[model samples]
Target: MTQTLEHEEVRIHRGPRSGLPLIVAVHSRALGPAVGGCRMRRYDGWRAGLADALRLSEAMTYKCAVSGLDFGGGKSVIVLDRNAPVTPELRAAALTDMGEFIASFDGTYRAGPDVGTSPADMVVLRRSTPHVYCLPEEHGGTGDSGAPTATGVLAALRAGARHVFGSASFAGRTVVVSGFGSVGSRVAAGLAADGARVLVSDVDGGRRDAARRSGYGWVEPADALGTAADILVPAAVGGVLTPETAARLAVRLVVGPANNQLSDDTVADTLAARGIVWVPDFVASAGGVVHTLGRESEGLDHGAAVRRVEGIGDTVRLLLKGAENPLREAKALVGRRLPPG
Candidate 1:
């Protein structure tokens, strides 16, 4: 069975030999072309993969809208087989075919990097399609967007700090980052640099080792959510802040780059009722999209992109202080730019 949302288009593509299940969901294009990252994961089934694509694409629309970008939101999910051996040739064949499939959109949808994908993979994608972004600097594209993404998250964290603790500095505050990937590592490093007691956790031992090397404290992934912290940043996966986990959270603020952090809409009310200030993931994680759009569409230099990302702090502060429901406020902000349904 195929599923989709209103004002959305879902396309399923299959590779010849690799049998890659590529699901692309274009959630909206009311503003401009749809843009989002390409995610690769081993899902339980096609239904779960499609659901993820639809949800992430819709979230991208809100993220772009809240970030003041002119593009709409879309996402591509490549479902991998857990038992299959991922040889180099198989990977290349799959990506090449996926690139061709993306190129068929003719810029209506653009794909970058997400979970299990990278700038290097974007390079592979460019081998077949010109519709890719976030390539290496030598390739004349914006490099990893994680830096600016982390930058924006840090800015929003400070804004949340001020809103909750009456100070903007991270000095003397305890922060737990639940992911140590490209974005999470940068956030942890930034917090450590700013004198925050940064603790990091990841399922990967290598990432935990890296966090230790960077002088940040380490927590096991199992204990990350329940760890004592002034701020809890779920930077890795989504649906982590479920009602059960939210009930046990030991933090005053929830701010991170994880998309769809809440398991469901009701979790927002759960967090709020628990007195935990929740910064909308779209608002907190928009720096990457903002940087990518600024550089790719607006011809912005690195410094200009950084400056634009810094504005995320102001936006978060405004939303937190002025709106009773920040997520609804963000959606309304996007709705104003979109044509009426």
Candidate 2:
């Protein structure tokens, strides 16, 4: 099936240097120049990668709009064959190819780190274009965005606590954090520090020992959705909050740093029907971009950047408390910020 694009522009280029297929989707330019991360992942096919680029880019539109970032939404994807192993030589070449692709956009689109890409990869990307962001701090850019992202998640979680539990603390609460990666580890640690009983899950069995060392219970990935807890933090991939998962969710509140958490817009209604306070992923996950743009683009000091990231709690509070339907209110907020065509 051919994927239809409602975006401002979508381009697929066969990398002249690496022979990899690179996709860049610019979903909107209503507010300003488009900005999003470069996601390099192994896909069954380039079409699947293109679909991800389309969906993630559109989510970034709402992410930026709702977070009050001036930038619009865009994303770049490097599609790798699922069966092929990525050699260091091949990885370097792909970054160069991605850089070249972003360079072609001039400044209309900028690339940052996401998923498989990193600040080191951004350094390699700088070899081709200046539109790359979150380069290592020593290179005049903020380093890994995971910390700020976790900070924002915790902030949102606190607000969710207040809205759902009538308290602002996670003390005596049981929070399930799915995906024990960089951001998930940090969120789990924060929850533990706040006296919450944190259960961590990851598809990677290697992380089990680390979760145990942190005094967190380990739940198998398959059981995470149905595990009873006060909250569920999905810090991994998108599309985890589908209708089927929402039906069995044992948590009172759902929020995390995962982008495109809902499989579709209708999942929001399904969650509402289930009585789950599902904070929009864009709102909860904006801290990384918020902090990066604050420090790099806005010339904010470190303290200012940190403070701005913490403001996500306030945003979540307003969204949850102001209306009967938070997702509807959030979409309305995004609609207001976006200029009419």
Candidate 3:
């Protein structure tokens, strides 16, 4: 194990056999045990993975705080080899190693699934750690948070629409959803069902095909960001809205489930200056955490959790209408609740 501690707590672990490199960052323990997902992906380098872990862990803290969860922020990133095929054996070995690493944290950190990870992987993780969540429904855990997450995004989108266009209804509105993955696909479908002119795009051919089969207008990945629409949703990955991209955005509102949506913090101000209403990603994308809290905490079931998640719309509305800077306001909301070290 080789660990580099930032102002926030962080741990780096290497798999004994698979040589898997993992970074765990615990941003806070003020409210309770740190809670976040474990993201497995190929990074440019170990340092890049470490940076991602740090950024995501801090976001997790704010996410929990904004969602009214009694948990701090933390995240784990498993670095993979891009050149190597991630076979079943490789995935199992890597997850097993990660589970053991998580177990060492005791109860201070709880792990769940993120990008490139799934409920099935959580089952494997549960073999080594009792703190794993989002396991298979048969295992008494929430199977997948995609539905709830989409619900939250939908709610937030409506709220943003109301704030920006003075209407909450999506009827006749064009919603360009970039990245038709698990959560993005749900979001796009929900918008379409609600009578929105939904346009979809994804880097993967299969995802684009899925969008087409679902009757959504397919936009190429290259033009998705520049599409003229009522709302531009970057649901794929982070840093898509850099200062340059924000300057060129044609939408009135920018809202999506992608974490760290702003390439740089200043991009929020830039968007604001350009007359674009930017809903903070943490507030809009907190449905999964709400679901997790309901499952992990006492007296809250999935239905109740979903109802709680719906409150995100109201939260976003309040923040957008009141706060001068929604991002800073969201962070302040968490900072006020955080306990002193």
Candidate 4:
């Protein structure tokens, strides 16, 4: 793949202690020092992990910009062998090495938890640098950001509901939540509590039982994208909405907390052609960043931080109702906040 050199800085290092590839892409520092999550996951190669880091970091730039955050965007990826055993000892070694790599940036970049990492891992990263967020509440950080993120998604969903269905209520609606993990599970529960018949799906079969136990229907991951429903919350991985799937998506609205939800920009056009209200993922997924930065970095109170997250609904409402193209309107919002290139 021909990679674009649009980012301000990019670095790849092989961890000396863990013998793993540690990739960090600083997409921009125009607003301020970059802030994004550190993701540890299996990848075919270090190059593939770097690709993901590049894409995610750019998305974080838009995410922060649209949310009115002062920070720019950056992301770190620790590539794991596809079939290698991730023993605790090895995990610690990789995390420790990553911490040291992050420390090299001084205060220019900060990291939080994402995907395979957790707040506990942020604790590990903090040992080498203070530029980590979302540490356990006991450790003085705001802790897991899932609830705040889910809250923001619900707010956006309500705005989207009003845009598409002429009401802001989830009542009597059939909703499908893809990916029953931290953020996804909370989104599912919130929708179910709002009187929406929620169906959940996960790539992990173990989550199926948990979904059912929560009084939600379970769909296999293979059948999730095509499952008919009023809305589809893609709380899982990216690339779920492609030209192929967008052609057959059975939902009227597509919104969630996933990053880089579209395979490419063209997919958004396809969704529009299909009359689907696809809220831009960068706009929909800024809650975690907003809450974490507000509480930990900006010294906002808990209630105030939550209020900022809830403001996402207003942002989405403005984007959906104020323009003919919400995606373009959203990018305009980001562009207005971002420094000139």
> All predictions: root-mean-square deviation over Cα?
1.9, 1.6, 2.5, 1.6
Cα lDDT of model 2 by residue, 147-225, tens digit: 9999999999999999999998999999999999989999999999989999999999999999999999999999999
Q: Write the per-residue lDDT of candidate 3 for residues 105-192, one digit (tens) a residue.
A: 9979999999989999999889998998888888888888989999999999999989888888889999999988888999988888
Deviation in Å, model 1, residue 286 alpha carbon: 0.9
lDDT of 1 by residue, 144-237 (tens): 8999999999999999899999999889999999999889999988888888999999998888677778889999999999998899998999
Tell me how far candidate 1 lies from the true structure as C-alpha RMSD in angstroms. 1.9
Q: Provide backbone clash counts, one per model.
A: 0, 0, 1, 0
TM-scores, all models, native as reference: 0.96, 0.98, 0.95, 0.97
lDDT value, residue 42 of candidate 4: 99
Better model by TM-score: candidate 3 vs candidate 4: 4
Give one digit per residue, the lDDT tens place, for model 4 in 1-341. 89758999999999998999999899999999999999999999899999999999999999999999989999999999988899998899999999999999998989999988999999999999999999999998899999999989999999999999999889999999999988999999888888999999998999988988999998889999999999999999998889999999999999999899899988888888888999999998888999999999889998999999999999999998856667889999999988787
Q: Which pairs, if any, clash in model 3?
A: 61-73
lDDT of 1 at 2: 88
Q: List the residue pairs that clash in candidate 4.
A: none
> What does the lDDT read for residue 240 in candidate 3?
94
> Residue 89: error of model 4 in Å?
1.7
Model 2 TM: 0.98
Ranking by TM-score: 2, 4, 1, 3
- Global lDDT for candidate 4? 0.93
